[model samples]
Target: MYKVRMRFSKKDFMIFISHLDLARVMERALRRADVPLCFTQGFNPHPKISFATALALGVSSDGEYVDIEIEEKIDLNILKEKINKELPEGIHIIQCQYIDVKSKPLMAVIEYSTYIVRCVLADDVNEDKLNALIKDFMKNKEIIIHKIVKKKNKTREKEINIRPFIRNLELLNKEDCNCIFKMTLATGSKGNLKPEVLIEQLKDRMKISILLDSIRVHRLGLYSIKDERLIEPLEIGR
Candidate 1:
């Protein structure tokens, strides 16, 4: 058996598709393309395909990965072309390659993700106030937020500090009264921080009204943390 890794992009209307549906779509495409996919052994067999990370709903990503096991080796370029023709619009394969099956899984190695957030400001809001709010937010060493935790048969609210999960934040641009920002935050099983939570806290702390419904968030890339350095998932095996 051979292992193949594929990097893909999810954008446009495909952003609304859930992770489960995306997997199904990929499986169908692979079958239509006639790729030699391996299947699990059981009464009800399934393709041996898995995704590295599940992109949250309503969020678009340019960097997504999937691993598949096949029964035979094939020309990667031809495989990509065939699959691309079978895939629907807004979902495209960017790159593909063979990888060591013994290496760590992509989900386990992901430690951080970078995102670009474009905030649609209210008519009365100004850039100076937004800048001041961001400055104030960075000044504090810890920002506490209440989260619901489940224990046994009961659920309770727990206070958690999100400062440690935030690695970097900066304003990218201001145009036509809209503010764009870039953020890098902890992700994966270790500790994950959602960008929406950060924005909610900022609005509360600064007492600024924003068009939360109009905000757009796009995930740029996911990375692995190693020795105080950020590494891309594709670099792990090489």
Candidate 2:
């Protein structure tokens, strides 16, 4: 089998679709495109596709990745064109490239994700104060947040210190109660941090109220360490 890595974008209405539904949509599109997708050998076989990470509900991403195993090698350009033609609006293929079959799956290799968060702040919140708050927040060695996890079918809230998981968080721009932030956080099998959780902590610490719906998060990209440098999914195994 030939392994092909594809980068795509999730935006607009597609951002609300669940990960399972997105998988179904991709499967349907692949079938319609007539790509020779490889399937597992079993009574109930499924498409051989794996996602880098699942974008949270209502979140958008500019760089989402999936690896597909095909029965035979096909032209990357042709493959990209075929898939894009079948995909619905708000989802489009950005690029495609082949990778080593023995390379680790995207989910296992991804280490960090950068996000651009845009939100409206309360009018009373001053820009300078917000900047100072961010500085102080990062200075703390521990920023604890409660996370709900299901263990043995029992759901409970667990307090976790997320400071170590946060690589960088900066206030990018603020104007007239509107603000934007850039965040780089841990993501992968080792650890994961959601951008919203960080936002919630900031909101409370800043003593400001932000509409839950007004907060919009768009993932810039996912990265893995290669030769001591961060690289995209397509460059991971190379």
Best by TM-score: 2
Global CA lDDT of candidate 2, please? 0.89
Model 2: residues with Cα > 4 Å off, grouped in runs = 153-156
Count clashing residue pairs in model 2: 0
Candidate 1 runs further than 4 Å off: 123-129
Q: How would you encode candidate 1's per-residue C-alpha lDDT over 93-141 as one tens digit per residue? A: 9889888877677888889999998887676556676777788887889
For residues 1-238, what per-residue lDDT tens digits would candidate 2 score against the true structure? 9999999999999999999999999989999999999999889999899998889998888889999999988998999999999999999999998999999999999999999999986554777888898889889898878879999999999999988888889989988888899999999988899998888988887666666568989999999876767789988765
> Could you list the CA RMSD of all candidates, in the order they appear?
1.8, 1.7
lDDT against the true structure, each candidate: 0.87, 0.89
Worst 10 residues of 2 by lDDT: 204-213
